[model samples]
Target: MSRPFRSVLYIPASKERALEKARELAADAIIFDLEDAVAPDEKVAARATLSRFLAEVDYGPRLRIVRINGFDTEWGRGDALHFGALAGVDAILVPKVDGPADLDAVAALTGKPLWAMLETAKGMLNAGAIAGHGRLEGMVMGTNDLAKELGSRFRADRMPLQPALGLCLLAAKAEGRVIVDGVYNAFKDEAGLRAECEQGRDMGFDGKTLVHPLQLPVANEIFAPSPDEVTLARRQIAAYAEARAAGQGVAVLDGKIVENLHVAGAEAVLAKAEAIAALAE
Candidate 1:
């Protein structure tokens, strides 16, 4: 069963306070981040801090994901090597993944689900091959790094980033892997965040990766099935079933043709709704 990825909050592993606060947060997943969030001076200590905390704490309901540094980095190998019998880790998020070989290297080091961050120019170009890797369970957009690599300024619409975003989305969908939209840097702009989350959903992303707990409510609300959507899903399923029983090949709902493909989509919406409801319990 795939758990909800909506509102995945990233907390710096070096920050003891943030880690403790995460236990009570409403995020569907908590990413204990050792990369990007931690400075060069605190890399080793952060890893140790994270390991020690994970060993003792029980962060129930929140999916425990650890975003380790790249394998090519000095801290990466040691981070992967010292799994240290820690419990409650659900996945290992590897940053700057260029291709399948990067996943292979990290997959060999840990038995956890591998999530690749497609950030670089090369990674975007190789998204198809990377998503096809057997160890890969998801793809995370690293738009900050990608924009820096591309030398493009961030726009409200993300017009320049759309092509790369589309490629990653298509790649992940092709392989049936979870793919999440990158964080919005403007943490204070609630309206802007809402707009971006809506865009991501329309593009078929599973969720939006978040940087702050304040972003959680919007992400969860936007990604989950709306009440109207759930109602429409139920209606579509019922209409389709009735049509099939009456020896009809198709059903019409809201004046549009509903086919087997549409029914499958409706079922998926209901499944996600049920899964979210179960998680709340």
Candidate 2:
């Protein structure tokens, strides 16, 4: 089954305390951040600290991703080389990726799968190419930086960001790549976070990136399949199977018709639900 990415938490690589605490967090994935989270003076030291922690730690079933500095910065190349060589990292997140060329540059240095951060206007325009890149395993919406570039005002509903978000979503879906929503900055506002997480979930995001561990429960709960959804999915699958057995083209589920396409979607939901359950175990 495809792994669930309901809550992808970002932990600054420089903080050993945070790293230790992360192993116990309920995040489906952990992003050991070596980019914006690290200070200029701490860049080199942060790498060593993260390296040591990774070597000594066991993060269980949680997917471990390393967000390296961009090659535009002096530390970016070194971060890539270091983490790319490490076996603990599942994928290397390349920040501010404008197109496939950015992924190609890093692909040369690392054999690991890449995740692109679509933060710039250029990146949004070339989302298709980036998402379809051979080495790219996922796409991350870098909404904060994208807003800065667009000079767009903040809306609780993210109105200004919808077009960009939709474009990236379509790109990821078309290429069958996993795309996660951007961080919800207000970690203290659980109500706001739930609203945004629901929005992302409705928009077909695989998950939501998190800035703080406190946000995990909300994202996790919001993204996972609901009990009602699971129940409906099982019923749809059973009805379809029974209809197929009797040589019918379609089956009625509730008041609506259940076709092969509906069964496919229902199976996907159950697959995701099972994956989440496996992760919990």
Candidate 3:
């Protein structure tokens, strides 16, 4: 089944309480972060904590990913080297990926699928090559770092980030890789998060990366197909089928013509809804 990545939550490996709480979180996937979320002194210990937990506990139906430090860093190489032994991990998410070479290095160290972080300007330029990597499964936006690199402030409309985000999205989609949007930093602000989530959805992101558990419900809701959307999709498909049966060239639903393209889009909505339902199960 195609997994629903509508809400991917990042949990700090150094925090025992947060890690414990993650087990019951409703996020579609869990990124047990050993990189940005952990302090320098705690990197090694965080790795051990995450490794032990993965080997022992089950995260239920959610996809379990581990975000390691950059390969250029001391801790990054160690994280990749030991991931093969970390049972129950679904994939290895590498931070600050600039090109295919970064992914190639990590792939050599472990056999798991690699998820590259599309954060740096250099990475944005080489997105196609990064997404085209044989072992790459998806790309995650690193908005905070990207914003810093671009020297742009956070605007609710995200005008400054559009070009870069679009380039990354196009590269990922062109290669059939699943691409998720970057996180909304204000974890405590539901109104802001909802607006940003809606924007991300409208812009074609499969999902949004989240920082806190409190943001999960909003992200999950914003990304998933709504009841009205599912209804329209079903109606469109049925109308098209009925038209085809009667030897008509086109079908009309709610006064709009439904073509082959419309049917395909409708089918995709239903497929996504079904996938979300599977995750709930």
Candidate 4:
């Protein structure tokens, strides 16, 4: 089945206003953060706050996720254990995931779908194995951590991370799992944000992990099928249908061969667009 998980927004667990604001946002998923966002002294309080909020809030149809700290950290394990039994959490985002073992350990702790973060060098190297892990639901790119760990400069085009990005995409696609792009750090530059969102879309991400509400619209717009694209997809499907009725295995559309594979691709695009449109209504 096609899951609508576009525009995943990150809401810091320590920020009450941010958590409340998520209820009113149009994100398809909300990632409640217990790592990076909270200070060392605030970890305990943050976990309690997140648990209480999750237990009490009505998140409607939006998927609720919690980004726990790395398994190596005490705070991370504590965050996972505290909310692992909570009812509303749809998935647990495990950072610094290096291999299948990490996923296995988390799955053992909670049956919740694991959204493994491909951040470190080891994680990138083992992306295929990690994605193939039995209980993984998806993969999220942790570009900032990855950049730091790899000692790579962040170019505007993200040239340094291309290999890692491709590996994550290949692994996720092979396993039939959702793949989301990393957050664009520049929240204030709307134009730059939109450009990066478009870049992520071009790279074949299912959606983008957003750090701010303003980024939501850009990610949604970039990921959503354009009117022209939808029209062409429909045309391709109809042409393929006519060809099939005539006992032909392939047909020519816009000077390109339209086969069963092409028809399936077109239909998938239409389905994704329809699902996204339905969410708006």
TM-scores of the candidates in the order shown: 0.98, 0.99, 0.98, 0.97
Tens digits of per-residue lDDT, candidate 2, 1-281, equal 39999999999999999999999999998899999999999999999999999999999999899999999999999989999999889999999999899999999999999999999999999999998899999888999999999999999999999999999999999999999999999999999999999999999999999999889999999999999999999999999999999999999988899999999999999999999999878
The residue-by-residue lDDT of candidate 4 on 3-113, one tens digit each, is 666699999999988888788899989999989888988988888888888888888778899999877888867777777878989899998899999888788788788
| lDDT of predicted model 2 | 0.95
Q: Kindly indicate the candidate among 2 and 3 with the higher lDDT.
A: 2
Query: Where does model 4 exceed 4 Å of error?
Result: none
Which is better, 2 or 4, measured by TM-score? 2
Worst 10 residues of 4 by lDDT: 1-10
Ten-residue stretch with the least lDDT total in model 1:
79-88
Put down candidate 1 lDDT per residue, 16-97, tens digits, no spaces: 9998888989898888999999999999999889987888787888888889988778999877766513566888898899
TM-score leader: 2
Query: What RMSD does each model have against the real structure?
Result: 1.1, 0.8, 1.0, 1.2
After superposing candidate 1 on the true structure, give the runs of residues whose Cα lies further than 4 Å from its correct spot.
none
Candidate 1 or 4, higher TM-score? Answer: 1
275: Cα error in model 2, Å: 0.5
Off by over 4 Å in 2: none
Q: Candidate 3 on 101-164: residue-level lDDT in tens?
A: 9999999899998898999999999999999999999899999999999999989999999999
Clashes of 2: 0
Q: Which stretches of candidate 3 lie over 4 Å from their true place?
A: none
